[model samples]
Target: MIACLRLFSALCLAALLAACASSPSSSLGELPRTPDATIEQLLEQATSAKTPEHAALLRLSAADMAFQQNNPARSAQILAQVPLDSLKPAAQIFASTLTAELAMGRNQPKAALAALSHPSLQNLKELPPEQQIRTGTVHARAYEADGQTLAAARERVAMAPLLTGDAAASNHEAIWSLIAAVPGEQLQASGNPVLDGWITLAQAIKNAGTLEQQQAAIDTWRAQNPAHPAAVQLPTPLTRLKELASQPLNKIALLLPQQGPLASVAKALREGFMAAHYQAQQAGQKPPVIEVYDSSRVSSLDEFYKKAQADGVQLVIGPLEKPLVKQLSARPQLPITTLALNYSEGDQAPAQLFQFGLAAEDEAREVSRRARADGLHRAAAMVPKGEWGERVLKAFRQDWEANGGTLIGVEYVDQPVALAQQIADLFKLRQSEGRAKSLQSTVGADVAAQPSRRQDIEFIFLAVTPQQAQQIKPTLNFQYAGDVPVYATSHVFSASGDKNQYNDMNGIMFCETPWLLNTTDPLRNQVTAQWPQANGSLGRLYAMGVDAYRLAPRLGQLKALPDTRIDGLSGNLGMSPSQRIERQMPWAKFVSGQIERLPDTPR
Candidate 1:
């Protein structure tokens, strides 16, 4: 019996050794611990790997090294060799994460998200914290690129526990920025306490009336959430905000033409600006004193600046005319910070000069971004034949081609008589008809065929007046291209409320100022009540005026924080590097002769 027991123990020992030999660490033996290991060495090792699993592990490491070396093509090649389905759970997760990183490098965030959704990521926690952090970072970036701001913040928040040192600090700040960029309407409490704390903090800052009130709100939030990440260390922007609270904007100079061609435009702007000021006073805040100056009466910008300085103007709001803005842009610096209501033609400008206006080019760029987000790659444009049309088309073409979209065709709409011909030519209906005619001639009889529009054109970018749009939409249908989507700027929308006019513009989508889309805004309602024309297209200028008021105090904040976006009445206002304010407007579609608001698209 003793001899039998000894033999049985030896057999058990042999089985245990076999299990140890096939363990994960041993099976993945020779896998590079660091990406600095030459990819060639890892690839060489992969060739002679003893097991299929070993081969995949080595190749995955080689692919990661290739990615680190910035050879995405080589990394993709090596990754393709790794058979993911047959790999261990950890290896599979690594493969998916690397695939996601590659997709992100190519600017394909949707593909990156799809790759990261591999089933093996469910076992991601089983891997090392480093691996988890890598996956989470890529996931968060993809979400951010794909315009899922809240999701990106949540991912960064989840990564907080795994990160340390500078990485942890950066991740923490990114979380705050992502949450801060979210529109106030979208800020709601998710069930997670950490995320909820962040949202509540952002809401507190957004809803507070004055700088002192904002500081108090921040203090209240930090006290309530003592252990929160942001509470422990406030975001850099919030810290800056605290510093800005000490310096208040007590006076502003509003410079606009009062008796020139722009007089009517200036009237709407002044009223909108004062309406916001009155609303702030009603809310029990010490609003700045606004002094109006007539640019038409002023002969020199230098004298205007000196006078503004003498008047204790902390900021100069405008000189709405293009010629005045061009003059301001030529200067190296200004006596006081000027927020010009018009943008200069020159690309360069003084650091102190910030430009904000209702530029049609902003909406044109929006069309390119929105079309790309909707997965359309080919576009054709139809703009009125003039300098204004040329400007809009130039903006659209630059943005479209930059995002890898093809401007397949363009038509200049000058006269109503040529509308049908222009539409047919743009869609290549003539070419289709010519081909059918050639075939019929060869067959010696007429072949029944409809002239079909080109299949390559994905959508049409329409820039026209509402009257022109009414005729063009129906003409496009007559040319057998009604099914193609039509995107337009705010110009296409007149806000005329004529159902018969809108009926012809059915199936068109346009981006317009929120001031027109949302009639319920308190300030807008009040302004419209006083100036009934504020309910029409003129409301866009009024909205721009209101935004200029909102933008004056926040210009410094926007410059300091590059990612900051103000939910303005005009649009989601953001500052470009050139100090020009850009807008991401809301979309609306004409359906059955009624305007239907579309959800905001990815920016």
Candidate 2:
């Protein structure tokens, strides 16, 4: 009777373990009531299995269950007990792949590669397409973990043809993201014809600006390599590419105030636009013939428009001053499509005119949106004392309140005392002091009093220069509101300031063009190399010029598909229904006297 009881207990344990290992879901939802108990039970059952094959299969199932429960170390331990060679070919592949994946999860890239080196796992094409793709993905991840980024990207690109539906879309996006991360100059021709073709195609697509150029590029590639496999699959991406490319703008007229207060800015823009033109020309593209018109030299925008029309210009890209832009917008019908450098004052702009500029109001609105996204609900603002500052503050308040955030307080400061008093009022520091005095009086003896700032304020929307920011940030901390976050526009970053000087402005977050923040970008480096004098204030204008030249041809696509965004040098360029080209810039925080880019936030 004692021996039979022991046998019954062993059978019950094996049955429970078998039931726990049967479910195959990737998540822990299918695990037994107690995962640890199930794993222990599985080990006991594996040791008492009837045959070696049964034991190996039981161990593999336990390893999978352990992994599902987020126990990678235990999973690896269970996998080690299994004799992979004793299993069937499919089972061996399964065990090896799972071990490799778990090893990768533990950041053991070498161990992962070792596990994947099994003979059964080699020659993945022998497996079904789905299995092959899965194994290839693991190999690609292993390569990435080992710091072989190009190798990883090439692995995915090689399998791009086999992916379909959501898999294909995700793979395509990953491939492009990796390729874009590598500088254009570093993309050399791989010895393989297929890879070389892909490299060449990627370069061509990068340079192509319009539908005609894209189609011509595809035709050229097809003619060069008629039998390549990519040619057969080219139509898939082409459909999406067609949505981004629009009709070509062969003749463009650039209008600027060449001899006025804005002449320096205009010069920077002209140089930047010409730089893009030269780049396209060098890439064997038939760039638009651009004509420069001095808005200051012409009597009115009408004369420039007529002149541009007579020259058969397909698009007009200027009128930099706001008043001039407003004048252009008031015209009954523009001779050609005009991309105004500045937006008009009214809500509605002319139908034929599209506006694109680095506007202060846009930056303010972006700052408010970012603050709200950061979970900051109550805001206080410190703005400069001027018309531009008023516009920025008003725009920020409107956007903040519209997004269900409250504007707790606002102050316009032109001096130190003004800023201090405004901050004190915003935080109700004086009220705290008055309350502390009243409590001391009620205590009927001289006592130490502790004042507290208002807890309602969550963030500060600061519109100030870098110089002002340096002085204001520390003052806010001294005033007992240091814990509250501070957000600002690109104005807080001079882009070429002394890094050490910005140490005082630490903890300030702002948004700026990737062109300024990512100084290592190939295009930015090239532009800086050519025009070493372009820095600080003019640098942003230069980026605007490069994007404007690229945007002229793609405007129709932006308008047609609201979801479309072109990755431009200035920022991610998109269009609003009001004909304003919106810029979505990257975010950065000043840390240790340097501007560091924040992790990308989802749109």
Best by lDDT: 1
Query: For candidate 1, lDDT tens digit of each residue in 203-296?
Result: 8887875567778999999999999989999999889888877789999999989897899999999889988889889999888999999999
Candidate No. with top TM-score: 1
Model 2 Cα shift for residue 110 (angstroms): 56
TM-score of 1: 0.70
Model 1 C-alpha lDDT versus the unseen true structure: 0.89
lDDT of 2 by residue, 223-309 (tens): 887876556556344545564454556899999988989998888888888888888899998899999888888786767777788
How far off is residue 584 in model 1, in Å? 6.6
Candidate 1: stretches off by over 4 Å: 1-31, 35-38, 41-62, 83-92, 118-120, 184-191, 206-213, 255-285, 291-311, 319-337, 344-353, 364-381, 394-409, 426-461, 466-543, 554-603
- How many clashes (backbone N, Cα, C below 3 Å) per candidate? 0, 0
Worst 10 residues of 2 by lDDT: 25-34
